[model samples]
Target chain A: MSDQTYVTSDPRGSITQLATPSRLEYFFTAGTSLSKNLRGYQRGQFIGQRCPVCSKVYVPSRGSCPVDGVALTEEVELKNTGTVTTFCVVNVPFAGQSIKIPYIAGQILLDGANLSFMGLIQECELEEVRMGMRVEAVWVDKEDLVPSLASVKYFRPTGEPDAAYETYQEYL
Target chain B: MSESPEIFTSPHVLEFPYSRSTGPVIGSFLTALRDGVLIGIKGTGGKVIFPPTEYDPDTAEETSGIVNVGPGAVVTSWGWVNQPLKQHPLQHPFAWALIQPDGADTAMLHVVDAGSESAMATGMRVTAIFRPADERIGAMADLIAFVPEEAK
Candidate 1:
């Protein structure tokens, strides 16, 4: 009964449109053993999963050895210091981006870990963020810590000379 | 370890950047919302599917006719959201409703902005509330919500 027609010849609006925005939030159970390890970050400690078969350490435990195909059942204390085995300088800005332009997001192999995990590199220039550069976690205040990687705001250069390429070449 | 240790879980929000094109029929439907009109396509058995689809919902048959269906309609079924979520059409308390707009034989899901739960009911009349004219961008959001007919 309304005068709303199906078509409009008016050239006012664009043909392609942005759909309604949406977000998803969920916190699934990762089990007590996993939670304990992640919570260590909040306490200014690093914990890694120790593979019994290969004796390789994995930070933020994978719950199992993806390589050896067995439950990685042991936990070991790890050092916050690590080497940046590889990295990329991010230049593009995204809708929800937190890091600034020309920031480095790198893969770090913690001092006592064999597996490499990704994290942001900050407090240093992009040109200075390099492979084999020794870096340490620049944590958010312990009071702000939650059982999340966000506790580590980002990693920064520890002022140690770059590690010998031979030291982390295998990681590359 | 046989004894379960405290396994921590944290919220990992993964946002993937993406953009995609909507094909012709569905494309026209959203385009109509942009211009402040509600369109429906006639499907099999003369049933109209609001938020027009390219294909018939039941039979998957090709459909051709486009018809104007709303601005006023009736709530077929509704449930009150005591607390609205960010994704909900309205930020405040409102009722999610399945409404059959006038001239349509089928109901389409939309939200009704009745101020309180007490104001909603099955078969209650509602009218479309478009996003403010200058602010409207072509999307489902252009047709923001429906309000109790008398309040319009």
Candidate 2:
């Protein structure tokens, strides 16, 4: 890969620079902030926080209530079933995307939880996965499970009727 | 809350693409490495900087001149990596060392491909091992790995 043939400018002393392509990596400490939510996965529990002011619950809570701006202290257990508040059919290839193309993924508002969390909608046709579709968590083998959302492989159709739009209208 | 998970972790891959002109000083040193030569620049106080920098790290002034130094040098300090990682330069037991090239006051960080931990030591003489010319493309990677002068 010499530049012998590709001479640029007059050859007295033309100083050209070189490009060094490289990568940098770092690890983020989950710390105490997101510890409780992660631990819940180990026991197959959907742990969340309840806002004392608004009574809204956040699944896998981040430190505070979004609307109230107050620290959340009350823990709540959310049901496995939830409504798909929104969704998209992914058909594009991307880095770190492990799922096959044309799969359904969306934000599911778990039962009794106010915040919507994202997960893949599986065990149904792509067209069958719609907004407000009822879905339940599909757990991976318990023996191989860890304290992470990955423990729930994906969300699958619950074979239940879609809730009336009015039930999730506030979320829209 | 009273119920808290002990620890949480997720895999995240980060990539950084640094695109810039090395200008004259750095460009020269790297070009020298491609030509099977090692170079440094004369910085303030008669000290030489290996893998030459555009400016003196301490004084932040433009460096003075280029000096040809060490194809040979002594290891000043090192850490042994017993369990080799895939991303590491060597896939075997090796030492990550800071070797001060002859005639240079400061040390440069690199790997030494000594067969065992017992084979490495401070003040051990080592030299740059450049990749074959046709295989080199003017990069720090061109200098494959340092080995004990005896091994060379």
Candidate 3:
């Protein structure tokens, strides 16, 4: 876009400001643990890794457990189902926001994964979103799957009974 | 896990995507660049800073005013990029240099298209080459690159 320039009048003096259009392009490599998780996504699976020390699984692991500081050695295939442990409704509009306003940006604790990851929660009324709400991954068409988390378009309410608060309270 | 996952690599762009107020000193400097001219602000001890900041780097004193500096410059220091990256200004190899333009006391960062690594050297005279007038905008990229000043 053409840069927009403006003259601002203030009590002190008028200042000239320009809207500087900028872009930074670079390559991003999904290293080890994330690579595994994304590879699973391409095959219609949710893969997590288990921390040997704490036995806790990390989805989209950072190649190691954050708390235990040890390599996550065991590979665990998790269900697409998950729980909305926490969320906030984005009602305010700002620059560079891709999703529409009033949508839920939730922390989803995938089944069998000890930790949660942020994902867009959709396909339900905004007021219906809540902690302990059961949700499921809504993936793109099977053939459209790729080695990226974007393969799953968003998470949606699963119509199952809400996971008990105690079941995911530790995650919050 | 028995089998290691294949490493996945993809291009990612982290962007600020917002307009920032350049204020007085920087605003004038960028405006000069868009006009195909170079300017510097007078600092403490009468030193001129190209790509001027609101405050003098050395004394932290407010700069006085803008002065026309250079279409000519000197390479104070430089490093060669043997293989240029995609984001680099020049698609091919070039020397990233700290160049002090003529009439400016402080050095500004820019690239020198000296054609080959052997041709680049500290204290080498160079000249700023601005992009076509129509392509000019109030940004650093307005000056496409510096080239070796023709031997006098």
* Model number with the top lDDT: 3
Give the per-residue lDDT digits (tens) of candidate 3, residues A1-172: 2112222232323335667667877777778788888889889888999999999998988788888788877899999999999999999998878887878999999988899999999999999999999999999999998877788899999899999999999999
Better of 1 and 3 by lDDT: 3
- Across residues A94-145, which tens digit of lDDT does each residue of candidate 2 receive? 8667898989888888989887888988889988888889999998898967
lDDT of each: 0.80, 0.80, 0.84
lDDT of 3 by residue, B60-110 (tens): 887776678888999999999999988799999999999999999889889
TM-score, candidate 3, is: 0.74
- Using Cα atoms with residue i matched to residue i, what is each candidate's TM-score against the true structure? 0.63, 0.58, 0.74
Per-residue lDDT for B46-72 in model 2, tens only?
A: 688887887789998777777778889
Candidate 2 runs further than 4 Å off: A1-24, B1-13, B16-135, B143-152
What is the fraction of true interface contacts found in candidate 2? 0.44
DockQ for each numbered candidate: 0.26, 0.22, 0.34
List the lowest-lDDT window of 10 residues for candidate 2 chain A: A1-10
Question: Could you tell me how far off, in angstroms, the CA of residue B9 lies in candidate 3 after the best superposition?
Answer: 3.5
User: Cα lDDT for residue B149, model 3?
Assistant: 97
RMSD of 3: 6.2
True lDDT of residue B151, candidate 1: 98
